[model samples]
Target: MIRGEAYVPEEANDVWLSVIGKSLAYLCLKQAEQADPDRMSGVLAKVKFLMGLGLSQDDAAAAAGSTAQSVRVMKIRKRSSSGKKKKKRRTS
Candidate 1:
């Protein structure tokens, strides 16, 4: 199989590729968690990565071993803490 201009072995079919992708993703999740000494940061990293993979909040939370509510709260907090410009009050 051809992968991004590089030739891959014929054994690397769709099924095998999918399995490899999933395995790699799971390994990444573990690595992300272990990379950080902080537990919360690790969980957040997992959730963020899983969500980036197109999983919904609930699914991402589940895959990340966290609660959906926690994911929602994290998203809310992230939005609130972001550097968004606030509307300036008009002088009377």
Candidate 2:
């Protein structure tokens, strides 16, 4: 059901196709950050969305024409930047 480097299966529906198509198109755009291969925030969001839909990190990255490492880095950066601290519990 999923597509990968060696596997190219047909999309099950138009919705999935549309989202993936848009993601790929965004990734291929020519931007000022030509030296950086990854498409950055918008593409990262798409990759995350795809991952939420059951695609593996590598597969989502490949679908967005990005590397899994970059996706992981983006996720880590996002998490760190969120500034959420764990609450301390009081011992009785």
lDDT of each: 0.71, 0.66
Instruction: Enumerate residue pairs that collide in model 1.
Output: none
Local error of candidate 2 at 76, Å? 0.5
Candidate 1 colliding pairs, count: 0
TM-score per candidate: 0.48, 0.46
Task: List candidate 1 stretches off by more than 4 Å.
Answer: 1-24, 35-40, 85-92
Candidate 2 local lDDT, 16-58, one digit each (tens): 7867765654444434236444544466766765666567778
Error of 2 at 35 (Å): 28
lDDT of 1 by residue, 17-76 (tens): 766666666777678677764752656667778777666667668777789998788877
Poorest stretch of ten by lDDT in candidate 2: 24-33
Indicate which candidate wins on TM-score: 1
